[model samples]
Target: MAEIQEKADSGKGGKKRAKKMSVHLDMTPMVDLAFLLLTFFMLTTTFSKPQTMEINMPVKPDSEEDQSPLKASNAFTIILGDDDKVYYYYGLVEDKPELNTTDYSANGIRKVLISPRIKSNDKMVVLIKPMDVSRYKNVVDILDEMKITDTKKYALVDINDADKELVASKTGG
Candidate 1:
């Protein structure tokens, strides 16, 4: 609501001038309406739900001896290192594991995961070993890559001494 008032001043002489008008705006109603709209929008609008990646881990057995050994032929290892570098090898690390370096791009790790041999082989297993220097996002990116490639069998394992040695030698770290 707004109100206008005119002020009349009596001069020293008898000369009369135009009265000055002042306007006062009452903003209580406007403020109340604004707050009401704010509350209504806050209550009605929905916030984005937190997104999550699903990872299915194997159940632990009662005895360590009960676990079966993973076949080297069916295993594919991916090592995550610093500087967004990825190293992969087929089967186990032998005298000289044929390690190949790649990035997180589609033409890199994705291509290797979807290769004819790896994709066609139903028993193919992906072992992801993230080094201490690797970022958490790298692990998430690799997991997303696994999902994108439709890789069914994958495990997150600790980087072993052999893997460390191979990475050091290949990366010249």
Candidate 2:
């Protein structure tokens, strides 16, 4: 049978050599795996919405006579009473009062002042000053309001003036 098989060969050879072929891997599976990984990453990424906080930022008084430099075009003045009522006033030095409202709470101060300023001009600054005896929460509320209204330039007014010092000393400054 071996001799018959040898004779069946069309070509004569000393020793037949096996043919060699290149190996290839299918790339479709690899591409699918890459896409799956990409999808997982896309889904896992965290998207954070913007947030806000309230703070007491200081403002330089326009002059010693009155703390109204804080009332300048870029200032925001807020007074809180012992009764917990809040008095908020804001406007440019030259312009009429943009906002003046006394709320039983600090709910709408930012909505009234910050929103208007932001929509009016991107370069606007709001210097916030809370009165003495004001609740700490009032300051925080104002800051939260500013963040919501997108007020960027904000400052606190420190009571360093002579009158403020006397008042603080008398009332536990």
Which has the greatest lDDT?
1
TM-score of 2: 0.42
lDDT of model 1 at position 35:
100
Candidate 1 has what TM-score? 0.84
lDDT of model 1 at position 124: 90
Per-residue lDDT value at 2 in model 1: 97
The TM-scores, one per candidate, come to 0.84, 0.42
